[model samples]
Target chain A: MEQRRSFLKMIGLSVLGTIIGRAIIGREMLWLMLSKLTKVQAAEAPKQYGMVIDLRRCIGCHACSMACKLENNQPTGLVDGELETPNRRINWSIVLGREDGEQEKGKYPLLSKRFLPRTCMHCIDPPCTKVCPVDATYRRPEDGIVVVNYDRCIGCRYCMSACPYGARYFNWKKPDLGRPENPQVPVRPVGVVEKCTFCKHRIERGLEPACVETCLGRARIFGELSDPNSKVSKLIRERGAFRLLEDYDTKPSWYYLPW
Target chain B: MTNIEDVILNQLTKTTKRFYAFIGALLVMVAWGAFAWSIQLTRGLAVTGMNIPVYWGVYISNFVFLIGISHAGIAISAAVRLLRLELYRPLTRMAELLTIISLMLAAMNIVFDLGRPDRVLNMVFFADLSSPLVWDFISVSTYFILSTAYLFLGMREDLSRLADRLPGRRWLYKALSAGWSGSEQQRFGQERVLRWMAIIILPVMVSVHTTVAWIFGLQIAKPIWHESGLGPYFVTGAIVSGISMVTVIAWILRRLLGWGKFFTLEIFRGLGNFLRAVLLIYAYFMIAEQVTIRYGGESASLEVLEFYSTGAYAPYFWSFVILGTVIPFLILCIPRTRSIGGIVLASILVTVFMWVKRVIIIIPALMHPVLPPGIGMSTGIYAPTWVEWSILGGSYALGALLYTIFMKFFPIIDLEIGK
Candidate 1:
């Protein structure tokens, strides 16, 4: 009878404990949700760095992509002498040939082409940063640029799955730089994620990104979106630019001016 | 000695040639897997087949599948305890042991998948409250500890009974028994404790799989994986796969230990009925997930479905449907095929197919390529390398070796409780 009574008492205590525990966790979750809402609201201010791309001026050249490879010191091919596969290759910016998918009608020798140069949009509200377990990836408070600390990364690839744009790249093998390392850019080791930093190093030194500098058409524009006087702000306001996958509400810094 | 004690305790002393050979083969497989893992660690993830879009591959699938299989032991034990099902008492020990072993393997698979296994300690030092990976880490580890304690506590009575039989290990057994003299009060207290544990562990089991599902389901970026149904879907699938595993393992133990009296034909049929019901629910979840994806009119979802139906992963998807679910369901449903032998065969098929189903579930969704056509690669595929396959083989061998070694030391079937 005593044992049964103790068992019932224990059950009561456990039930109460679980309820109290759940209430605390529930309150914390509600607080987190509220804070996240406010954080999203705060992110809408125009104080962050951003970029604008003019598609009409992009002449289907691979200059930006080439410059990104050289600037970041990314591997050109795998160690086995074969060119890196498109899915596995680590490129900060990749140029997609318009001929692959954007073949429009009316092609009687008057063929026009348009290339889409893709890079990390540096989202103001980054899902990748939120999902990273170790805080290895985070959006900088000052600029809202999503950056990865390669040294702290455990290579779980959870961030890779969270990025909607497929912007993240995993270092599958030892990063075999085809050329000598650039002393300016920090060299990342193997077994970590890497992506475009919006030329944060150069930005700190008061210079434009390598891709923006080397663009043959001067199509890639980089500036502070927060400042109304900045060139990017004037371009976005005057030309009516649009961001990719606006439905996701990531608020990408990179905007496109349609042809 | 009583006939019950004789039958249960006799099997522990006999180490036959076949047992030695079986354990030897398992050791070889484990060695091969270790060698493969070393190569992976030394050469980076390049040794595996994983790439950018399909960043997660066979290792993650194995982790999910093994974890799913681990659920069977606890779910069964808890159900038996809660419902007062005397027929299942003999299975509790083996089931709990299976849970512990499989959970360890599941955790090991995560280590194998990591690009830098050395930095896993960072998860402990720098735990994030928001990340689902952290949730998974906490839930799985907690479940492991709780289940181990539960298993050990339940073993006290059996250990006490067998303490005097083995003179060399008597002290170990006595210590493990922990001063339980089998008085009325002790038995009463132990029963109460077991009952409470049964009540407690069921939700933990549910939470473990739900958190695992959240690791994928909460990712809004991945179309097929981002779904509300993932929690219940993973749990239901875990139960189905777990029951199938228990059925297969119980059958093997019945044959090996010659415990025909304890694990009768009726017990097998009872388990088969339970598996059939769980499989039906699992099939419903599959339909609900696919139908929701199809009706939602999301291009990414449609693209993933197309990949499963007619594209690269079509073969695996269809085989999972036919071999994993439909065939096993039919076998269990038919009266002629519901016998012990038929049930065992059906269970073997179900267990094997469940692993394949996990692979099918993981790969196609990943290969859908969410990146826009102008930016990233249009198509990506993953085929596991020999290193991955070898490691997979090694994990299975390790599981078998653990079970074999455990059987030698302890009583797999509790004669004191089960009549």
Candidate 2:
């Protein structure tokens, strides 16, 4: 009888301890969420924004690559070789990968490889922002554009790992310095993570991203798909294009079509 | 009395030499690994075998395996304390030690893969508090602390004994035990607190390994990793591999430290049953993952499934399935086949195979493209450079060295332990 009483007493104490610990953690989380709510309102722009990629005409020119580098100054190479290249630069925004459906240089040797000019898809259901413990990165409700607040970012790489798209990059070295410095993308510090923004700076200024503006072949498309009357909505409807990785349901803002 | 003094004097004299030699050996290997990492660090990631199609490789796989192995220590320690399983008494302290050492190394391996280890502190400062990785950091640390405390408490009465008797390091043990007073009331309090820690540690252990599975599973990149099954799979894998590690190490220690009477063939048989059950569970999950992917027939999922069953990963995959699962299960299931040496061999094999399976889980998914065809979203194939292997070697050596140092100071197989 005495042992039974003591066991019950122990259970009561443990339950009380756990509840107190949880209450403290819960309170801190609530405070963080509230502080984030009052700080910025990217939602003021519009909801349901997206992008469409024109697959056929992409010449792999890497102009989008240059624009991103000129803008953000991301690290030159993950691990650059000791030797030098003619450009002495590495491509961050531009990469050579097989088309989602094509094979090359074998029995069907003549089949052409397409240039994707890949960047962050900026999903409507952004997993990266959702998993950000510090509220350092968030999606603006007004336009549904995801953005990162660098000052608040603690380079834990949780965002880096959470991103399923492989879109995010870390500034392993110091952020690139001495770019012509378009204010579209901010240069990151060595420790914090970075990625291809949908150009929130350009969006705030009520303009398209510099890459969308500067596309020679005009392969990239950006606009508010929510406003069906918006140019992006019209183009998406007319051209029969789609967002990348739709099955995963990230609801990316970027779309591509093979021209 | 003179004979006892002579023995004590001899052990004391050997301490510094053994300590230096052990540390020197580990440091040399660490330096070698550091040099290799430097090469990979200096060269662009292009130096690796990775090209557009396969992104993750051996390094990431090893990371997952090591982290999984790290969990067994805590699991065993917690299980013993929670159920009051007296059979587990002899094993708990070593199990707790394994937990701390293995987990620290596992955490280090994750950081080692980062392009910038120098920026690691940012996770402490600027980490996304919401991300599972952040949760992983918190849970692993919590487990580390709890496991360490559980270890100390189990040995507290013993530490106090040493403090009272040993003159040279009376102060050290005194400090460690925190002036433990052995009133009957104190004994009761210690037991109560330990029971509490043991209960708390169970869910935390499950969360930590399952969170690792979530890291890849939640990612949309690899269809193989995207399944909900990964959590259960990882937790089971951790327990099985962890038990195997403890068994092998325990067997070895029994021979080396003259601790045969305590460890016993019966203890080995109990561990054998433990490994066999988990391995069968592991096999069931493996088949489930393959069947789901195969029957679903999504080209991407099929590709990963086919790759899992009979692709580039086939050799290692079969090796893992056979050596880690089938062979051990075969031996351990039959009582006649079960011997101390046989169980030890099986344990060692399971540990290595569990690591290989993790490598397969990590690398193959990166092999498949996530975006639409002709969109150029494919990852490149990557082979770990020599530097990665060196760091891995350094990590294992470091883990063993930590265990060695602890053994040198305290009698790990002391009669009162696990009691």
Single out the weakest 10-residue window by summed lDDT for candidate 1 chain A.
A37-46
**lDDT (CA) per prediction:** 0.85, 0.70
DockQ scores for all predicted structures: 0.53, 0.27
- B364: Cα error in model 1, Å: 0.9
Candidate with top TM-score is: 1
Each model's TM-score, in the order given?
A: 0.94, 0.83
Count backbone overlaps in model 2: 42
Candidate 2 lDDT score at position B220? 57
> Chain A alone, model 2, TM-score?
0.73
Residue B334 of candidate 1: its Cα lDDT? Answer: 94
lDDT of 2 by residue, B280-346 (tens): 8989988887777777788877887677679877998999988878898988977778999889888
Top lDDT prediction, candidate number: 1
Candidate 1 lDDT at B131 equals 80
